[model samples]
Target: MGGAGNPDGPTLGGDDVRILLVDDEIDLADVVSLHLEQRRESFSVTTAIGGNDALSTFESTEIDCVVSDYEMPGMDGLALLRELHQRDQSVPFILYTGRGSEEIASEAISAGVTDYLQKRATSDQYAVLANRIENAVARHRSERARQETELRYQNLVEASPHAIFVHRGPNILYANDSVVDLLDIDDRTEIYGTDPLSYVHPDDRDRIDRRMRKAFDERETADWAGWRLRRDDGEIRHVESRGAPVSYDGQPAVQVVLRDVTDQRRREQRLEALNDATRELLTAETPEAVAQVAVEVVESVFDEPFVAIWSYRPETDQLTTLAVTEAATERAAAERNEPRPVDTVGGDLEMDVFAAGEPRVIEGYADHDDAMTEAFETVFMLPLDEHGLLSVASVEPRTFSAAERDLLGILARSVVAAFDRLAA
Candidate 1:
C-alpha cells in the first residue's frame, strides 16, 4: 500500500496536496501519514521508509511538500533535504523527529529546511505539523503562480504588433520591439528613461500632454487620439494612440499603445478631396470640362503628378488629348508635338484598354513601347465609359492598391455621370 488515502476520496476543485512522509520505521511513517490525511481532506499522504525511497517517490510524483524524520538509516532528514533541493530548490521540506534540540533546529535552518517540528507522545503535535505544511505549501504555490503570470505577460508584450511603451510621469520605463521600429531607432535602450513627449510633434505636444496628465491623475484610460510622431530621422508619422493606467516596477505608470495610421489618414484625406472634386465634376458644362476635372483630381489624389485625359470622338474615331497635368506635359514634351494614332497596331495600350472597356495597370511601360518615355515606369489606363480614357503614370514601378483602384473607379463613374448630364 502507498499510504493512507483520504476516506472522503480526493479533494475537490484541485485543492489536493500530495505530501511525502519519510521515516526509517515503516509503522511510524504509516501512522503519521494516516493522521495527516485524517486531519485535512485536502491532504493525501504517501509514506517512504527512508531518504532514498522518498527521493524515488518525489521524482515520480508531483510532491508539494516533504515531511521526513531527523534520524533515519542511510540518509538523515538533512541529507534528504539536500537531495530534494537539488531536484527542486523551491519544493518545501520539513524536518520532524523526536530527537529535537536547539543545535538541530539551527542546523535545519542553515540547511534551508522550511520547518523543524519536535515529535511528542501527544496526538496534538500532528496538528501543529499539519498547519506548517499547509502554510509552506500555500506560499510555494503562490510564488509559482506569480512567476507564471509574469512569464505570460512578458511574452504578450514582446509579440504585440502595436508600439507599446510604459512611462512614469515624463520618464519612459520600458519599450517593446515595435516601439523601437516605430521610432526608426536601432536600439530600444536609446528611448528608455527618456521623455516620450520629446518625440511628439511640436504642434501636438501640448494636447497630448494634457491627455496624458488627465489619465495619470485620474488613473483612467485615455481615449484614442491622432498625434504626429517625429522619428529619429526627423520624419513625421501620424499615429493613433490610447493610454491606460498600469503598475510598472510596483509604481503607478501609464502604458500607451500607438498604432501607425499615417497611410490610413492620408487615404482618408484623399477620399475627402475626391468628394470635393465630385461636386466640381457635376457642375462641368461639357465633356472637355469633365476631362479637365478628372485629370486634376487624379493628379491631386495620387503621389504621381503625371496624369492625362483623352476625349474619344466616335464620329472621327480619333482620341483627342483634352487635358494634361503640368508634370505630364513636362515629361511628354517631345511626344506632345507628334501624337500617336489610336489605330496603330503597337504602342497603344491606352486605346486598347479604352476599347476593351476595362482598366489595366501596366508596369515597366517604358519597356513595352518604343514611343513611351523612360521617365514614366508604370501607368494606370482607365476607361471613362466611351467618353474618354484616363491615364496616370508614375516614375516608380508600382501597381495601384485596391483602395486606390476603388478611388479611381469612383472618379471615373463621376466623370461618366458628368458626360451624361452634358449629353442630356
Candidate 2:
C-alpha cells in the first residue's frame, strides 16, 4: 500500500459495486441502470423515489458508491450529499442532474461529487460515465494505499522471500519479483485474467475464500499461513499468504503478498526434533539417565565434555558436582562421581558467579592458584537456576571472553527459565 502512484484499473463491469441511484423520475433512473449494467460497474442497482429513499437505502445496505439527481422532493441532491459525506466521507458519489451550469458544477464538485453529468445530455455525451466510475475506483485504491504505506509496505514485501501479487476483480495488476522467479513465470501479463486460486493448492481453496470474505467485510488485512501453493512447473511449496482489500480496475478483489518459508520451516522441524530427543533424555528419573541426556545436548553444542553442572549450597557458598557428563574422550574416571567444593578447585568461582547474579567467563585458569588451574582450563560459569551454575569447561587453559560469555548467558537463562517454569 505504500511507495507508489495510484495503480490504474480496468473499467468496472459485473463488479460487486453497490450503487444507489437516487431520482424522482423512476423512468430516468431505470435508463441509467440499464447503461451502467452494460458497463458492469454495479453488481446491484437500487432505485429510490427521492433523496430520502436514497438515504434510507444507504443506511440499510453496504453501499459502495452513490449517484443522485440534483433536484428531488423533500431533500435535494445537495442536501443528501452533505449528509452522505458526513456519514462516510470516503465513499464515491456522482451527481447526475439537469443542472449543468458551470457554477453548479463547481459547487457540486466542491460538495464531493466524484463526477457531474447533466440529465439533458445524450447517451453519447456520457460515454465516459464508465470511465468516471473507473477513476473513482482508482481513487479508492489510492486512498487505501495511502493508509497502508504509513505502516510498512516495502518492509513487509521485502520481509518475504517469495513472490507477491494482487488480483483485482478480473485482472492481475501487480506482482513482486521473487514470486515471479519462483514460478519460472515471465511477466505479470502472463497471470493477468487468471484465477488466483488456480495456482493455490486445492486443499487451501476453501480457506482462501473464507479469508477473503473476512478481509472484505472487515476492511482489514487477511492472511493464509503455510498453505501449499503450486507453481507453473507443477511444483508445490509451503508459503505464507496475505491479501488486502483493494480496488482493481475500478472493482474489488484483493492485493496479495506471498512468502516462501519452506527452508526455514524445514530447519525449524529439525531443531524441534533435536529438542524433543534432548528433552526425552533429560527427563530421566536417575542421575545416569540425566547424564546421558546432558551428554547429548552438550555434544550437539560443543566439542568435548566441556560442560559440568553443579548444585549450589548457598549457606557454604559452594558448588558440589551433582554429575559430570562428557562428550569427548575422558581423561579422569567420571564414574568415581566424587563431590568437591567448587572453591577448592576454582577459588571463589561458584560464589563469585552466584553473587554476580549473572554469567561470568574465566579466561585463564592460571589467573587463579594451582588448585583452580588443575580443576579446569577455562570455565564459563552461567547460573542455571537461582543459585547453581552450569559451568562449561575447556581443558585448553583459556578464558571465556565477553562475546562467549554473552552467548552462554542467553543459553543458561533459557535453561534456568525452563526449570523455574517447571517448579512453578
Candidate 3:
C-alpha cells in the first residue's frame, strides 16, 4: 500500500496522484498534509473542511482516494460512501477518526468503506495513516482495472451484429444483445440457462435437438442453418445458427452465432415470381410474342431501361433483328459510340449466349471487340431457347450483377420451357 504523493510528483505511469482529506477540524487536515509532505510521499493532497466541502472538492479535483471522518456537521461519512459508491464503486474510501467503535466499523465496511482507522496518541502516527491511504489507492486502481476489463467484454458481446450466446452443457447461460433483440426478450435473465430449442419452432426442434446431440457426443462444431425461431411477438425468424464448444465458467460450453438471411430469401422469392411471368410469355404462340414478352418482363420486373430480343431465321440459322425499345434518355450515350444502327447481329456473338446458356456483362462493348462497339455501351445477354440470344444494352457500364445473372438465367429457363410448349 502506498500513500499519495505531492501534486506534479514523479508518478510511475506519468500521471498525477491525488488524495482528498475530509475532516471538520481544520488543524487535523493541516497536520496530516504536513506529515505526508515531511515524509516526502508521492501524492498530490487536497483538503476539505466538512462533508459539503469534501463533495465539492471531489467534483472539482481528480481524487484517487478519499479519507473522511465519521461524524460530520452536514452529512455523515456513511452517506458519503453510499453516494460515492453509486458514482464509482471502485474508488476507495477510508474512515479515520477518534470515534472508532465496533458498530461504526462494521457499518462502514458494509457501506463500501475500504479501511477504518482509529485516532493515534502520537502525531508521528500520521505516517501509518499515509501508508493506509496508499494501500486503499492501490486497491482502488486494481478494482478499476478489473471493472474496465469486464465492461469491455460486455460491450463486445452487446455490440456485435451477429448473435452470440453461451450454452453450458444443455442450458443457454448467456445471449448477446443481438440474440435478445432477435428473440425479442427484454432481459438476459429471461433467456439465461434454458434450452435454446425452447425458442425454436416446433417444426425445426427435432433437427436442432439432433444437431446438439451430435455436437456434444462428438465434441464437434454444430451447424443449424435455415431454421425458424419463434419470436416473443409470435413471428417466426429465419436464421442460420452455429454452435461450437468453448470454455465458459472454467468448463466446456457451446458458443453460438446467428446470421439473419431473411432479406436474401425474400429476394429469391421475388426472382422466382419474375421467372414465372417470363415463362408465361415464352409460350405465347410466336417468336415475336416471345420477344415481346421477354422485353416486357425485363421492363416490368427488372425495371430495366433497355431490352432486345434477337432471333435466328430457321432456314438460314442467321440472327435477324427482332425487337428493341431504344431507351430515349440513355440512347445518346450509347449512340455516340455506335456510328451504325448495330443492325448486324453477327453469328459468333449470337451463338455465344445461346450455346453457353449463361449471361455475360460486357463493359464498353468496344473493348470486347471493335465489332460490338457499334451499338452497345454495356450489354447483358441471355439465351432464348437455343434459337437465338436475348441481349439487353444499357448505357451504364457494369449495371448487371451476379444476382442479376442468376435472374437472367432463370428467365432463360422459362424461355426454354415456353419454347417447348410453343413447339408442342
Pick the lDDT winner.
Answer: 1
Clash count for each candidate, listed in order shown: 0, 7, 9
Instruction: Provide TM-scores for the models.
Output: 0.72, 0.38, 0.50
lDDT of 2 by residue, 315-416 (tens): 766766555554312423332244432332324666677668777667665457533434455766777666366777776767665544554455455455
> Which runs of model 1 end up more than 4 angstroms from their true locations?
1-14, 23-35, 68-90, 95-125, 146-219, 229-237, 241-263, 282-293, 329-346, 369-371, 418-424
Alpha carbon lDDT of residue 9, candidate 1?
30
List of clashing residue pairs for candidate 1: none
Q: TM-score winner among the candidates?
A: 1
Ranking by lDDT: 1, 3, 2
Worst 10 residues of 3 by lDDT: 1-10
Quality of model 2 by C-alpha lDDT? 0.66
Q: Indicate whether candidate 2 or candidate 3 has the larger lDDT.
A: 3
Off by over 4 Å in 2: 1-10, 39-43, 141-424
Q: Report how far off residue 25 is in candidate 3 (Å).
A: 3.3
lDDT of 3: 0.73
Q: Order the candidates by TM-score, highest first.
A: 1, 3, 2
Error at 298, model 1, angstroms? 2.7
Candidate 3 lDDT for residue 297: 76
Which ranges of candidate 3 are over 4 A from the true structure? 1-16, 34-41, 72-76, 79-90, 122-132, 146-159, 166-177, 180-193, 197-255, 261-408, 414-424
lDDT of 1 by residue, 1-424 (tens): 1124422232333478899999999999888988887778788899999999999999999999999999998999999999988999999999999897999999999999988899999968877788888888887887787678757766898999999999998999888999989998999889888988999999999999998898888899998999999998999999999999987655788999999999898888988988999899999887778888888888767665988787787887756677778877666654455443222122466667788999889889878755345657898888888787788888788889998888888888888888889988
